[model samples]
Target: MASNNRQNSKMTDDGANVTSTPSHDTRQASSSIHVNNLSYDATEEQLYSSFCVCGDIKSVRIITDRLTGNSRGFAFVEFKNTTAVSDAIKLDGMRINGRPVKITVAQPRNSINDNRVVQNREEYQRNTPSRTRVVHCKKSQYDVYIGRPEYWGNPFVIGKDGDRSDVIRKYRAWIMKKPEMLERAKTELRGKVLACWCKPEACHGDVLAEIADND
Candidate 1:
């Protein structure tokens, strides 16, 4: 057996710290119990049959390995009433197949990433500015400023007379420029438009007029 770590603690067969009941406000009307310390040889049907003594059973599942299809040594048994779940926990550590069992209320499965992945993703998004854009420079220049052509003078107009090396350097800086306006423009365009085109009219006059009117 592999030694257990915090990340894989819930995978254990000992239900001691493996399972917990839902909060008073969230407890379901149905009674769902987690059974641990199950015999690797025990089948799902056997587990359902064993727990049926407490009350009517709704479902049973013996969790198994995905790759090998072998039992993970734990199972979930659901009863028709919440009272059954309470009663089952009292029978915790009861013997089954010559081995003691651990029983408790079953909890919902945490997603694969859970809190750790969420925190990391949030931190990354926070540290990095969302509006930054990367553009390649056509010319070489160390210093460059990025602004809209309508608002800021055309960069190409100034670089046109410079030496080839200087022009290349300036274009490179333009490519690397990160501007707030560019970020805003990207945000405005994102997901707003779909890849689509209007059907063309066989003739130019009325069809063009109709298209313009529709716009």
Candidate 2:
């Protein structure tokens, strides 16, 4: 992942230029942090100014609506080291853009922790009624695990500029080819509802729902 594209320096209300620079290497496997409750208008520059104080940031990706390009109120920040992740956790209740952000260490897509999660999901599926529904996401009810598309952005699908079909194909293949990776996703959506912007038109969410709801 590339570092944030915004300029790392910002001017405070007192006309002070505050620059936060990353002093580390490229990235670590588990060095990413998940941030929620972000103000809708917050930008990459704002996030860099807030987090660059800890260490080097590899990237900042705020989830957004593919069609409207509006903030989905959540983002991922990858630091250059584990230490920075720990420091970021302390900022869990710190205000940014007028809202207290919730921060946590993000688990990588493939990890030993994920294996246990898959096992738990298998158990949950066996115990519960199994079905699936698709619905539009209200701001507050977005399921961080299920509602969020695994292939929403980079490191999953390399969707070219304006190539929506390529993105869809990749997301579908991820769900179909690697069923093991989606156990938690399946458990989250099985017999439950999921939120997506498009319906009746095939989408990444439908790919997930199809794989999760069926055998």
Candidate 3:
């Protein structure tokens, strides 16, 4: 009878232990989250400090532009406790550094196929004709056409009656070879006809012609 009672007690302890494991798993899963819509000037320390109000922060990462090393305006913060994640989201759009910040749980990174689809969609939007304008090349002697964004559309024909197609092809090649030039042109022509142009669409041909003639 003594041996039987000991065996029954051991079985009861095993059942209790089994029931507690899932609760521990739930606690582990709730801790981390993703944050977004960060200010361009935000630093990791600032982010972590801001989030600490909710709970203990395990880590914080702010994504930045690779070339310029500037903030990409987003970040991810992980909490040591799951309850802190909920509190952090409640603080979403909370002001930090004089700018509103967006915070949310981080989704798992997409697979390669998903990334390819996103890239293709962005490329399609960028290449659409209505969205871009053709500009006559002013930099070269030939009748080269450049494509600019519609907002910055300022197409110009450097020489009289230049072939629009040839200009477009040349501009496309130039953009591929020297992509930085496009950004420079945008900055140079800001708040005016040239800055808003999308290359190769000639959306601002007349305005560009006047500007060139004035020059």
The C-alpha TM-scores of every prediction are 0.39, 0.41, 0.42
Best to worst by lDDT, what's the order?
Answer: 2, 3, 1
The alpha-carbon lDDT assigned to residue 104 of candidate 3 equals: 73
Candidate 2 structure quality by residue, lDDT tens digits, 1-215? 77674447889999999987756664445788999999989998889989999899999999885423568799999888878988889889998899999998897776667899999999998997647666565533444333344443223433452255676777666555554446555566666666665554455766666656764
Clash count for candidate 1 is: 10
Per-residue lDDT for 148-182 in model 1, tens only? Answer: 34332224433464754454355445523534433
Best by TM-score: 3
User: Which residue runs does candidate 2 get wrong by more than 4 Å?
Assistant: 1-29, 111-215
lDDT for position 76 in model 3: 79
lDDT of 1 at 203: 19
Give the 10-residue window scoring lowest on summed lDDT in candidate 1. Answer: 193-202
Q: Rank by TM-score, descending? A: 3, 2, 1
Better of 1 and 3 by TM-score: 3
Worst 10 residues of 3 by lDDT: 18-27
The lDDT for every candidate, in the order shown, is: 0.55, 0.71, 0.56
> Mind giving the per-residue lDDT tens digits that candidate 3 earns over 18-53?
222222222224466666677787788888788899
Clashes of each: 10, 2, 27
